[model samples]
Target: MRIIFSLFLVLSVSTIFSQEIETVQDSAIVKVDSLYREDQFYLGLTYNTLQQKPQGVSQNKFSVGLSAGFLRDMPINKDRTHAIATGLGFTFNNYVQNLAITGTGEMPFYTVLDDKTVFNKNKFTQLLVDLPIEFRWRTSTYESYKFWRIYGGVKFSYVLYNRSLYTDDQSKVVITNNIDFNKLLYGIYLSAGYNTVNVYAYYGLNPIFKSAEVGGENIKMKAFNVGIIFYVL
Candidate 1:
């Protein structure tokens, strides 16, 4: 009976020691994961929509495109609850249309009077290269409640290529003639996302053109963008 009691005691001690070792291993793994996530890099894609309201024009217009870019998190605290990311990307848009023509200057290429070519209102495409920077704030941890993220940044884009107009149609015009293809672009971005879906908006602080005389004195590009982004290492 004394030998059996000794055996049971040894078994119980061994089980407790095994459980303690497992708990330590689990804790070490969690710490490693936290460190990795804090310093990781990511890339994503987004769909964007733009609007322009020229100072003298009465109509409000919009454009749509897809954007691709890379981002990195800049943690604001040791816990990595807040971060900032900045990167460069390109946006591709097609089936574009121009809405709201004002003044006596409506383009003949887009008007009903044009017999040679007409604006489909359903067919146009624009492509741009953009740079974006965002400041973000996040929740404390993966299991935390009341979770949210807010980002504000800017994007500079140049219309690298466009398929929305006709070369023969002199009526379709963008006023800025001296635009430095390398220098001129739009700016400012704000967004909110939960987990994998984010809604973003942008505003152009600079004119796409060098002068207002051509596209007009007050034409500007402003946009509201809504798209889904997945984090990939």
Candidate 2:
């Protein structure tokens, strides 16, 4: 009967091309399990508010610290949304204030009428060590889970040591021969995080102390900063 109607129309066109190749391999295994199924890491804790600017001093003081770091995820367009992160860290600080001396401010000369020496006072403390590198702009959906993230970076610091001394009454341990640690610092950071805890702010254009003249006139050191970060993952 015409060769069984041409073998039943070639087995119905080979069963519709084998059901369209198993529906394209089950939609590519659900798009590779939603693109890279999961594997990322992060652990963090940071706090910084150190300040110093002495080129023409107008009185300024602030210092507080603690930091730790490690974060990963850098994606540059691949239907992976977008991501970037790089952070390495260290911070330990303290800068308090209360100094007054102006009775013609005779360089370290105390006449008992005006001498409130407590500027740059240290009692075995003053440390700052930092290295922060960042760049992140992720709008979620790269897959593992994200609610928000926005970062900006640039942070480098050095002042790994400090000293303080004062022990009189026949014990003599006065080591306050002008405190100034030639450190090079730069800042401009911003951050926002959720699920791991992140919040930061820093603004220092470099000026912690390189100016002098207590009775001749000339001093500068003052800027601004803010902080709060905790992402122990």
Candidate 3:
């Protein structure tokens, strides 16, 4: 009877010890997983256009944009579903339009080319350094690699380099770093979707050029962009 009682006690203690060790291991795993983050790096491609264009100005060819960046995500809640992110990025933008810039100085000539005017190429390109601040919300967890997300933000850009080129049968005109362009630009943007693909849009709050005139008309054209963006861990 004594031997049986001792064996039963030993078995009970061993079972309790095993359960305690498992509980500690599970707790450690949960604590580590709760600190996971999402969408640290991003790449995007956009179709670029002009908004609030002058009466006769129109886009020509394909105006394209490319952007890439990394974001530092800071979770505001315990679940980490909501976050605020800020990052630095670079953008390359090309605007092919009927507007012609003819000179390379502080006071350059601006013209809105009519459809009858034939030109081989007329476009302006910009390289900008972008700073983005955004609010992020996602249905994401450590175990779920795919989820839905919505991110909205305002971006500030500083133009690093700019060029305008026009070519035709008669002559070729090129302008570099024209002072009329707004060196500092700001815009609002939004992105939303699931998994790896998201739709993105941006609307510039200010004009692309400052004190730029076309036929005695003040040029107040803003930029508009729409495209797809991808996020990666």
The parts of candidate 2 lying over 4 Å away from their true place are 7-13, 16-20, 23-86, 89-130, 133-139, 143-156, 159-181, 184-188, 192-201, 205-207, 210-233
- The alpha-carbon lDDT assigned to residue 88 of candidate 3 equals 93
Give the Å shift of residue 78 in candidate 2. 23
TM-score, each model?
0.59, 0.32, 0.86
| Candidate 3 per-residue lDDT over residues 1-233, each given as its tens digit | 99999999999999999999999998888444778889989999999999999889998678999999999999999989999999899999999999999977566799888988998999999999999999999999878879999999999999999899999999999999999999999999999999999999999999889889988889999999999999998
Off by over 4 Å in 3: 1-32
- What are the Cα lDDT values of the candidates? 0.52, 0.50, 0.93
Off by over 4 Å in 1: 1-63, 98-124, 142-146, 165-183, 209-233
Score residue 186 of candidate 3 by CA lDDT.
Answer: 100
All candidates: CA RMSD in angstroms? 6.8, 13.5, 4.5
Clashing pairs for predicted structure model 1, backbone only: 95-124, 96-124, 175-214, 175-215, 212-216
Q: Which window of ten consecutive residues has the lowest lDDT sum in model 2?
A: 105-114
**lDDT string, candidate 2, 168-216, tens digits:** 2444233332334346666777867664566767676765544443445
- Judged by TM-score relative to the true structure, which candidate is superior, 1 or 3? 3
Candidate 2 lDDT (Cα, 0 to 1): 0.50
Q: Which candidate is the best by TM-score?
A: 3
lDDT of 1 by residue, 109-133 (tens): 2222233335433333557776677
